[model samples]
Target chain A: MALKGWKELPIGGVIDEPGKSREFKTGNWRVLRPVVNLDKCTHCMLCWLYCPDMAIEITVNEKGKPQMLGFNYDYCKGCGLCADVCPVHVIDMKPETEFLKD
Target chain B: MLTNIDLKKAQAVTGAEAVANAMRQIEPHVVAAYPITPQTPIVEYFAKFVADGVVRTEMIPVESEHSAMSAVVGAASAGARAMTATSANGLALMHEIVYIAASLRLPIVMPVVNRALSGPINIHCDHSDAMAERDSGWIQLYAESNQEAYDLTILAVKLAENENVRLPVMVNLDGFIISHGVEPVEFLPDEKVKEFIGELKPVYPLLDTEHPVTYGPLDLYDYYFEHKRQQIEAMRYARKVFPKVAEEFYAISGRKYDFVEPYRMEDAEYVMVALGSTNSTIKYVVDWMREEGHKVGLLKIWMFRPFPKEQVQQYLNGRKAVVVLDRSTSFGAEAPLYEAVKSALYEASARPQMGSYVYGLGGRDILPEHIRQAFEDAIEGNLLADEQRYLGLRE
Candidate 1:
């Protein structure tokens, strides 16, 4: 539906509050975290199968036995598909907000 | 009669009416449009205003959405406030000129009534129509409610016309939900809208006779792709200018909105991610679930073209489970929204488990319980969507 009339936008300043020391780069914080459970994990590759970013990598043990995969968190935005599709309920969500205050 | 309301007065109106009023206030020099479902009444009302001398803008009746967008692109390049509206297949048809409008930095504002993209033809809302043109270079803004549709239209004009961001902007509204539904809308005074917009100043106008700059000059591969690279830089400016513009809008209107809205998400453990009308329903469900002590929230994506990557990464960072509600299917691949959110989370170190549900395809009404079911699915580790589970399908 349509909203009410137009609102005026003030030009020239980026900071909203008057006395804020820390300028926040809102994009720096991660929203979603994935944790892997080595016990319940199956070597079945479903998490790697559907990963759009190819963030998950499957590793094998020294004895060549199938082992659980690991994820690259550098570019991950915390969308938990790897955790979601893990046949074994091996991965869980850990939010990133616990550390970042802003 | 022109009904004058408070500058800060907030109310809900149909998407069509909201867009029409926004156009009236913007005072476009030319409004070229072809009547299409959902977007038809918007132009119709604007036509009436022009006929009755209520609005002093030239309302040009065009044969197609392509022509409508083309006419506005040309007019805008020549330094005129130009705007139009279209829906579904009509937007798809205007695909050719849409990219050109952005590449040339033509600040034309168009309201696209989000409808299902066709094959086995459907004429209702989903998001396939808008999502289909995601890469068209236009700054995409998805509106959940009517008020957002209207306010975003104004913001679209302001943002698109900004010196830093001279790309075209498309304010998307769901077909029936916002287009047909009417509510009490406070129409801003023409003087106030003019005041807000100020005078139109074209930086490198096409019509400048004294300092003539070539319009659409042919370039070889050497400079051709670089021109497109400049367009990318302008889009980066669009991402930054969106929140800056929103902050200014909040200052005057007292209504604040972000590129992506996070609702009751401070301590939310379970979240549903979607866009358009579905967000409204999701919000209601989130509120209900919240009262019952279930930690649930909703993230309504308003800006899609620039993708608001940084903002989304921050807002959705700490949730336990994220259920991406994809309204449109990506055929054999995962849904588009689902893919974007999933990728963003993957980039962040701290991310939650992401589950996807392909619901509300072909105009199906996604309900509150369906969202609850998705939440349950996320919690119980039911990742794959069940074929039989449809939200508001007609039996």
Candidate 2:
């Protein structure tokens, strides 16, 4: 969203939109990004619990089994917390510029 | 919609008690009080009111003044009518969140008993506490008597809750002098007060689960300045909304209130300017000086924040000279009220010769004679514009 002028902003700095936090794509300024392999042997969900930004995505399949998904880059600040917390060593830190060309 | 208006009978009550009575009538949704000297009896009485089932309010006995303010901030953010009362040190402790309360535009009403900020450890009447928060973005109203202490507190709810003026308000009374001394204060009908204040229509309330919103979110450089500017505009808009609220109050109470109450300024060449309870002393002196044929009047300022600069200039414009009495000083700078009056009259085509006096620090006695001397100096042109003369201070 475009930044508003002083008069255009709402009174009292109230951000009325509940889920606008996703609009802040913090991955741009990060030096490196965390890449994860969802095809790992085990889905321990350890990285999901430790990711401070809630960037580690997890989904449930139709069989009621937890499946690990890739890192959500929208809010990930490239903190490498998810890479550090992954037990299977499937997640790695790579340069954010490497994925920029894609 | 205020009708069948009848002024209630007057009863003598201490200033603190009067404030409590006003708060009870308003019946705020929440009150977080941590009592200090001169501001204790106010919340104590309100707490009793709550205990006795007189008014159903969630009165929190907070551990500290900081948490007291924090509690009310949370309550008011959740779209409740919230209030608190505090004194010198208490206000200092609440200072950080006090700014947050105003910046967040919560229409919280607070009663501030003016007391000396102590290093020498004094519990007495002075404007130091309120003066320190001059730029904190709260609308400040100084009460001269118990009647004003009662009336303005009630009026402040309407003033604060006005859609255009959704900022916190501080209704101030002198410590001990008004807070403890008994005075004949007229009370409004409880239902009339509730009717006048209407309801709290909070904007973007945090408690609205159907439409969730953020309060006090970090804006950083991207939007912090804009939010601050928005709060400044809210303060500015208060001046425009003040009179409309005052008019509505007049309809219900039959009392007219203005930003500055001028006591007999017509055709007067010399004027005395002051705030808080000292106006009563200056008024008595003004009467005495008029009987002896000195054309002197008193301009008792009621609203200090969003300072009534234009109204002050209009009143002091044609005067030959004027003396401004400040109950608190800025240590090195000209006193707050005096400095404000000087700047307000700076652009006047016929500016009055200004005499600044700092008096009654630490609740020192300000007799009528001190006010008479100030007026005499103004009339005789014996005042030095550069000097801040002390009144009743033992050098």
Candidate 3:
């Protein structure tokens, strides 16, 4: 969409549409990416609970048990909070360039 | 389209009471205020009205001026008609949020009882407090009398809430001089005032669940500049809309108003420019000087924020000399009002020789003799080499 002129913007810096923060794509600012080792993961969910950006996604298995699905890189800012809180040491902060090379 | 058939009778009251009465009639959704000298009575009166159920307003007696302004911003952003009152140091305390309120384009109406900014702890009438926030992007309307104070308070709400001018407004009255002095003020009936202001239509209220909106967000270089440009556009729009709003107000109250009130300017060679209550003294001096065969006049500024440059030039051009009286000093530079008047006539083909007189700082008394001396000095070209003079100061 073409950006409106300053005169066309709403008063008070109001964003008329709701839930549009998803469009910001803060992941572009990330220098590092979170990498998870599923086999070593204890399923403690501490990383999921402690993720500041809410970037950690949790999934369920066929037996109806919750499982960690690693970070959602689209919105993750790579702050390393999830890795810091992972007791099992399954999550590692890797440079985005290294991950892309692999 | 208003007729006097529903106009209410006049009452004797102080400027503070007049503003409080106007607020009660407007019945805004929220008024979050913290009191300081001179302005305290305004909020106190309004709070009593709220308590007595004379008006059903959510009166938040906030602990500090910062919180008071913050609450007003939040309420206004939520799409409610919100207001507050303050004076002097109280205004200084709320300086940060005051800028935010205007930048957010919230139509909050604040009654600023003008008092001297203190170091020696003076609590008296001066323009220092209002002058401090002159560049905060709020529309400023200075009242010269209690009647104008009452009238402008009502008009400020309409001006601020105008869709084209969605900016906060500060209705300024001189501390103690107008705020505490009792004068006769005619009021529009409650229904007429209600009808005149009409309904406040918020563009994108935060309370609207289905269409949620962000109030204030972090906008850096790319968007911040554009937003500020939008605010400038709104201020320009206000300059155009103010007269029309005043016209509507006149229809109701039979009292006419303008951005600049030029008294006896036509055929006058020397004129003095001033703002706030000092205009009354200048006008009196002008009358006395005229009777003595002096071609003198007074130009009173009612609207200061948008700085009606064109109107100023129109009245001041071709004059022999113009003297600007400022109640506050700019310290190392020219006084604020003087700077504005000089710049307004800088490029005029027939620019007048202008001088500045800084007077009434820290509530120093400005007698009619001081005004007479200012006019005489300007007429005789006895102004300081720098063209700035101090009035009523002991050597």
Number of the predicted model whose DockQ against the real structure is largest: 2
- Pitting candidate 1 against candidate 3, the one with the higher lDDT is 3
lDDT of 2 at B125: 90
Clashes of each: 36, 0, 0
lDDT per residue for candidate 3 within B1-395, as digits (tens), equals 01222325667889999999999999999999998999989998999999999998999989999999999999988889999999999999999999999999999999999999978798998899999999999999999988899889999999999988999999999999999998778777899999999999987878888887887888876578888998999999999999999999989888888999988988899999999999988888999999999999989999999999999999999998999999998879899999999999987889888888989988889999999998898789776525678899988
Candidate 1 TM-score, C-alpha based: 0.75
- Candidate 2, after superposition: displacement of residue B257 in Å? 0.5
lDDT of 3 by residue, A2-86 (tens): 5677867776677878787887777878998989999989888898888888898898899988898778888899999888988
Q: Check candidate 3 and list the clashing pairs.
A: none
The CA-based lDDT of model 3 is what? 0.90
Off by over 4 Å in 1: A1-102, B1-12, B384-395
Residue B212, candidate 1: C-alpha displacement in angstroms = 1.5
* Candidate 2 wrongly placed segments (more than 4 Å): A33-50, A56-72, A82-102, B1-8
CAPRI-wise, candidate 3 is medium
